[model samples]
Target: MKKLISLIFTLTILVFQMNLYSQKIFPFEIKEHKLSNGLKVIVVPYNSPGIVAYYTVVRTGSRNEVEPGKTGFAHFFEHMMFRGTEKYSDVEYNRILKLLGADSNAWTSNDQTVYHIVASADALETIVDIESDRFKNLKYNKEQFQTEAGAILGEYNKSALNPFQILNEEMQKLAFTTHTYRHTTIGFLEDIKDMPNQYDYSLQFFDRYYRPEYCTIIVVGDVSFNKVIYLIEKYYGDWKRGSFEPNIPAEPEQKEERSKEVKYPNKTLPYLYIGYKVPAFDSKSKDVAALNVISELLFSETSELYQKLVLDEKLVDFISGEMPMDRDPSLFRIYTRVKDEKNVERVKQEIYNAIEKLKLEQVSPKKLADVLSNMKYSFLHSLDNADAIASTLAYYVSVTGNPYSLDEFYQTL
Candidate 1:
């Protein structure tokens, strides 16, 4: 235990030195503004001439799903937004995207929904006009709503086919009680099945969560702040603010271990997943930073367990650890795929032993430095393009309302 504490002290010193060196080199000249309607816009000018990345981040997701019966609307809106506005039918929107040579997509998660497009810099005005129309004047009939609901159910069924997805669903259900995080972003199966009949409720959900106050528009690459801001204000100015605020219930502390078992009907390798409750994300917190490093220290491929169970003994086909940055307290999960059913018990013991070692002794300085350096360079390398940079900023913006939180996060490491 003293060795473990000493390791923590060493890691803290290393992180402090790294933070000092990084303080002088902030990555981007991020300019931010807020419209009267409470819509935020961030502009970053990069050297990539004649190309731009535009993003609309809605700060609502499964986390806003407080009602028991109306659970899936957060994800439902991801599909609904594509159904198009009164001015542009779904077919017309596709045609517009094709003509402009734009790359576009959207995704929903535990805390936010993001819609994005990459297109020629010259098409900025057209892109703004079309995207603004959908957010402000989106319109759909009951028939359209029902059709999308059916499609969502189909998607849930498809996900159920995957054993990993099944495990994740069960893990979430077992780990969380009162918190909406208990359900995946796809939401409860029953909620999705009944979504078709909740057309009116769908409209309410959009009105409550899709307001201007809950959204941010991020643009990076060959663009001027003046031009982007002017265009956004002109297009999104009339979008109204909302007064509703969701009182998301918090998950109580877990006092004992939780476990579940499953038997896939089809013959397949046995799988195991374990989750331990952790705190809500704070980019500057040392505890969160340590947990993030512990994930690497204990389970990363260079770690002792991976070398023994995966590459040497070959008892496991796959193994990984995840510590997600989330708006609420979440789980630190370990997953393993055992090659043979008979080896499952031994593999579980080995994993437990690895955790015990982590709690008892400190990781080597060499291993800590290597993992931290690799993670640093990995992030820097990912900034090779405008889309990548924009995507990275969108994530931080959703988490802390400031893209600079990315810097603060790495510094904490």
Candidate 2:
């Protein structure tokens, strides 16, 4: 334990130093700079030939929604961003992308909304200016706002058709009561239909959150980090920071374990999911690493229980578990598909027994090593994609305010 702690301390130091020497990162070089207005810039230089990916991560998501009856404003803005700016109309924006031979997409997660694009690096400046303009000065009126709100409602309708999304919305609502996580990011249908009534609030929302300080810009692939930084400074230097730090509520503790079942309109097979509150990601905490190891041993595919339950006996069609990562204690979710609802308790018992065995038995040496190795390979594989690497950095930055949680995580593992 002493050795492990010392190693963790040393790893933390290295990561800190690496980030500090932000003069110019090497081997997929990343240069971190803060604008006068507070937008964080991460420029990654790669020589992948023609293709480049530009990602803008806005640090506000559903977690930031705390107003009464305004559940999904963050996600709603994700739709509104495309409505248009004074300079770029909707058709013009789409046309420019087509002319530039670029494809663009954006998504809102629980903690952040990221706008991403890939094109020839020659179009980098245009993409940067367009994104900056949309973030800084958006143009939309009542008609556009209601139109997007209606579109979001349509999206919610489509998602409600999928039992998985429906149950997720139901499960999270049950798992959280006070925090905005209680509502699906798509929001309650009523609040969405009423979004137009809150158009003024929507404008305030944009001014309060969509600032340079709340955003991180990343450009990767076949680019010069030095040049990209200057370009960002030139185009986005004047962009302002958010006036108010989002007032996100902390979730209250779950006093007891909670379990729920959802029978969908299209139910054919039975699904069981259990959510147990778990500790958050504390890279410095050994106990967090232990929980990670515990989850891997219990539910990872190579584990004996998974083999017995899903591969050999076929009692379960599939099984998976997640310590739903968060800035606070999130749920450790156990998901399984069984023969029928009658088998739910039996499946639950088997999983509980597997967990119980951990207290009575330290995992086998091979199993423990396999679990760690699996995580290492997966983390390494994820770094191969430029977009994946950027988004991963953005998530850690948004969630923990420290991007090197990835390194400290491995040290604990």
Candidate 3:
């Protein structure tokens, strides 16, 4: 009877994995429900025996800031959320989660903040209750708020001393004149210094965002959609709606390309940055696929450029570039450090030539096909765990509202 039961369970898991790519099966297999108050719920069942991952994504970030001197409130709350709620004190929450064998944490980024927990499937409902309570009724005394604010300031100070972090802060400010993206997600030092005094603004900040409408819940692993949705409705249904939307100033077009050279006399090698702003990620954009291909051909160590710049000639420390994943248009930046200043323009021209060649016949059909095939296979290879799958879903959902674009992304090739 045990062997029969195990065989039946194996068949059931196979059925769900097969239906993962089906359109008609989409709603029932991996459910999405929106509450009357506009909260979004995503229930993903994996039946991976005993584990589950639950995440609440709030769609407010540093980009949502509009007040002149009060940037990074979204980031500030990432630290504050742990301080405590009226009902669930930090110690008590941790104690309860530990009792249930759950591990949880939260993160704030340029576009979103996600609070998450992973645990035995048995603890799913308890996790829901704790998170929903705080989302609706988070309360902190002034002293606690002030205390957390100082910690955020200290966190900022530590990051500011990092050379890469310092460069990015200055780079964003220079890249954008009017857009909120001008400031780093941590905001400017001058602004964060005054954050604690703006207590009233902090309260208003919570009121404006962090609403049911501004958040989405994702639950994955050994569970059923009905049970997860039922848990979501029980806990999150009554949370208030969000009324505010951010009005970040639109970035003006760059009329001419620009380059900057700053001698951080503290460094042995000179740092160089080459930047070009591009429209952000959109599901229908195959150009993004093309950009990925271009980057692979030009920037990888296997590429001719890397060997020439760093190994053959020993002119540059390394050549690297990245295309950001964002809901708003972001920059494609090429950064490198040279052994000496004499070869800066020479290396920059080579980088430009590489980009220009991508527009020409730079890649063979077999090579391009190999890259695309490798990309798809590599993505699937990482889906062996519940958290890996959930995190991948979260990444795409954070960029586009949809994650199943994984299919269309490959089909576009």
lDDT per model, in order? 0.86, 0.75, 0.75
Q: Give the per-residue lDDT of model 1 (tens digit) for 248-295.
A: 997876777767787777667889887777777888877677777877
With a 3 Å backbone cut-off (N, CA, C), the pairs that clash in candidate 2 are: 46-222
User: What C-alpha lDDT does candidate 3 achieve relative to the native structure?
Assistant: 0.75
List model 3 lDDT by residue over 257-314, tens digit each.
Answer: 5556554535555667777776677654655545555556678787878988989999
Residue 125, candidate 2: C-alpha displacement in angstroms: 1.0
As a whole number from 0 to 100, the lDDT of residue 148 in candidate 2 is 82
Order the candidates by TM-score, highest first — what do you get? 1, 2, 3
Off by over 4 Å in 1: 1-21, 24-26
RMSD of each: 2.5, 5.3, 10.1
Q: Name the 10 consecutive residues with the lowest summed lDDT in model 1.
A: 1-10
Q: What TM-score, computed on C-alpha atoms, does each candidate reach?
A: 0.95, 0.89, 0.88
Candidate 3 runs further than 4 Å off:
1-29, 263-265
